[model samples]
Target chain A: MTTGQRIDTVFTLFVRLLLAGIFAFAAYMKLRNPAAAQAFAESIQGFKLLDPLQHHHLTVLATFAVPWLEILCAAFLILGFWTRAASFAMLGAMGVFIWAISTVIERGMNLQCGCFGEFSFPCGDTIGMCHLVRNSILAAGCLYLVIRGGGRVSIDRLLISGKPKVERLGATPTPTPTPTPSATPTRPVSSRPASDDTPIALDPVRPTPLSSSPSGVDAAQPPKPRWD
Target chain B: MRFVGRVALILILATVAATVHSLYWPIYRDLPDRQARTQRAPVTDAAAQDGSPTPTGRSELPEHYISVARAYQFWEEGMPFVDARTAAERVVGTIDGAIHLETRNFIDGSATRLLEELDRAFPVIVFCGGGECDASENVAIRLSGWGFNEIYVMHEGYDAWKDAGYPTEAVGGG
Candidate 1:
């Protein structure tokens, strides 16, 4: 209901859409051209993560799995379904990419990035900081998504019970505690605006409780589920 | 943590789904296998610089790969040289008296006239810009497909040839 909360919602929505569009385009570019798969495979060899000669099958596996994973994660991000999970997946991908590119640079290898498949940016003999900077920014965005759940427009907001209100920087003290699950099963309580009080599907967003931490501050943070 | 576990689950699910889909999707399957292409001869830089001495018995070179020195011998013998580099790349210059047939033009029928006039008995030496450039190998593959048996790929390509102080002709200058 507050102005700061409204701003947070808009910013979160913008980030999710921007990241989703970028990843979707990236996935499509790699998948559209079948020949690019080989180019991608050769680029992977430049990383020196695996010997192309000895572990050819692993190279093939990476070539197929990477772009497909991007598509899957990008789709989830777009729909705002499992937003944090998809963002985490993208973050992991960015981490791997940063490592791979740094390795090539460290070894003084001349290689085409083959990043956007056939539509890759022209990289001459040397790798530069531009690639690193781009991945870093994208990683930051994914990290933000993980910390802040998908905003008002997201499926997570519509479906998850007791979803937290968008937390604005330097906003008022934390809102009231969430009603106990048994106490209000029929009407799930949320800090969201009154206009968003419409009934949502009953299915739990996650298979298990993400965190047993009480609903004030700890619930708004990243999940800390105890593994038994 | 729950975040790590969730991410792991997404990755596992995505990998499994993609593996299954790849079996049928044209995107993941039917990728060009460059490994299946014809094997190329490996010539060390030192060896390429010091091409084998002309053998006494046979007039032709023994290996499909010829070094800078042997390439000169072929030049002295008046064997035809083909420049396999792209037109833009060729604008820098090329081997003196070498013929250029852009690899892309091979399928477009532009090289047919040149193909018909070739001397089958003598070997044709092919070279590109060199230093990880595969244009020469690709051209050699196409030449072999066309039944040109005596084909030699100049291992170090034109860069090595020019670096060795060999005769070269520029596009604009004589």
Candidate 2:
């Protein structure tokens, strides 16, 4: 790999590990014990996103489900298994957080964010613009991971080593059929365009959405030779 | 599509795991039982001491939910009331002699002093926004945990008491 490509790989790896640590710690603080879980529930109650009296079941579900989701996603992130999917899950969580924080700010309620049990930083305990900004930044990171998939060092790369994106279903390993001069017909086995200068699908199963959610990435850039 | 499938699978796995965890370690394991029971009358024994609140209490007061009429009768007997509504809701008014305690206070222990100074001599009645409100029940359970002898939840809530024209004090001119 070129020096610049190696640097990019390292940076991506760093982000993945950092986010994994953050989510793991958050899950630990919340799920440590029944008392800790209750405390976290109270923190969620502080946000008042739902009425405790009316939406009791939903609130309870959130109390239980959120931490588990965090831990599971963190685990996936750490193993670099289904890394894109894990990033998507975290992105969803961050979206909820951003929405809730904004609602709290709009209501002008002074509430403990209950985000990291009792541990809050930069923005402190009180929910405010800083919290919104922090979550937004994290959301951006998750989006980046989703777009890029796991980096060179990821288990995903190790598992899918010889293939370009995914191997075409039931297709043979053969030289590309001669290119048609008049029209560029569909090449099912082809994961990338012939030229590196042009973008292509990251995976064969899903269309690379050019305009959806900060996904403006060069799709066909060959994976920099394993970042060793 | 594959990414979406993986994401859905992760969420499903997490949700199933969480459901199991919740059953194993309930978040409300420490919560004083606040089930709605119209089973018994308010106990009058002043010396009833159950020590710190536990999930299960031997006192029938935990099962005591009184009607507004009965709550008003207690009020006439000079019983102190606890208002468990949000500060904004309480501004609409509360029972004239009610002490203010909300759910958050229980979590943070900010109302520890207030709870400490309360007169345990009389049975305390707690109320909130009447129908569809569980705040009073919640706060009452906390007070019961703190060794309050006879705790009452006014099930009809504050609106019924106010609409019935009982004594109430409005705050912030609300």
Q: Model 2 over residues A3-88: C-alpha lDDT tens digits?
A: 77678778888889889998898888777766567667666766777776567667667887899899988888888888889999
Clashing pairs in 2: B130-B157
Binned by DockQ into CAPRI classes (incorrect, acceptable, medium, high), candidate 2 is: acceptable
Candidate 1, residues B3-121, lDDT tens digits: the string is 67878888998788767755653321111122123333233343347654321112233355679888898899898999977666778799998988754446445778898888765
Judged by DockQ cut-offs, is candidate 1 incorrect, acceptable, medium or high?
acceptable
Worst 10 residues of 2 chain B by lDDT: B29-38
For candidate 1, chain B by itself scores a TM value of 0.64
TM-score of chain B taken alone, every candidate: 0.64, 0.68
In model 2, which runs have C-alpha deviations exceeding 4 angstroms? A162-228, B28-44, B47-174
- TM-score computed on alpha carbons, candidate 2: 0.58
Report per-candidate DockQ: 0.29, 0.31
- The positional error of residue A19 in candidate 2, measured at the CA in angstroms, is 0.4
Q: What lDDT score goes with residue B117 in model 1?
A: 87
> Model 2: C-alpha RMSD to truth?
11.4
Clashes in predicted model 2: 1
lDDT of 1: 0.65
Among all windows of 10 consecutive residues in model 1 chain A, the one with the lowest summed lDDT is A200-209
